[model samples]
Target: MTDDRTQDAPVEDQHPQPIDDKVAGILVQEEADLAGHDQAEILEALRQRFADAGIAISEDELLEQSVRIAGADGGDFSDR
Candidate 1:
């Protein structure tokens, strides 16, 4: 049988464009820990961190990456 998860999950890039996957996850997690899991806050945190590092990233790209990295409560991302 086909895996339901594969069907439902958004295809992720092999590597994040602006930063590393591990680094993105750490940033996402830290923002959540500090700000209580609000998507906007996490996204802003990611945007700011990348900016501070002199990495140019688009808002659309960051939002998409954040969903994969942060995941909603009980969402597919967290399961992985």
Candidate 2:
């Protein structure tokens, strides 16, 4: 599925990339691990993981549902 949110954005293809299924699995595993932790801990862990992976995502922006699910009311999914 194409995401309308990013569909209109331009991507810089600076390098050739190869498909790696392992990377996809790792991401899924990270989300599963996050699901088992509290909101705060999950966010911290996610931030740390992102840093380790050389991905930049600040706590303020990372706190969004895409990285962690809030336990408020019916809960808000990061829609990531």
Candidate 3:
């Protein structure tokens, strides 16, 4: 007998670009909404959100990504 799981796998595994694009779109859309929020609160919220999505990311990683995203948007987070 042959394994059948491969036939039931999601197409996303074969085409992950769209999924990545969608995630980026979501982050961009939420960027404005995140402004003025406490940095720690935002980090915790992001950590929880990613955890809920079954993704694991450290606080430092989240902070680094947050700074990078802010910089890309012409914002300064050095004071944080």
Candidate with maximal lDDT = 1
Q: Kindly list the per-residue Cα lDDT of model 2 for residues 9-70, writing each as its tens digit.
A: 33523443432442344345556555545777766666676676555555576676333443
lDDT of each: 0.58, 0.51, 0.56
Per-prediction TM-score: 0.45, 0.45, 0.46
Ranking by TM-score: 3, 2, 1
In candidate 2, position 2 carries an lDDT of 71
Tens digit of per-residue lDDT, candidate 3, span 17-68: 6545644544554455565566666666666667664555567768865654
Clash count for each candidate, listed in order shown: 0, 2, 0
Error of 3 at 68 (Å): 5.5
Comparison by TM-score, 2 against 3, better one: 3
Sequence-dependent TM-score of model 2? 0.45
Candidate 1 residue runs with Cα over 4 Å from true position: 1-36, 72-80
Q: Between which residue pairs do clashes occur in model 3? A: none
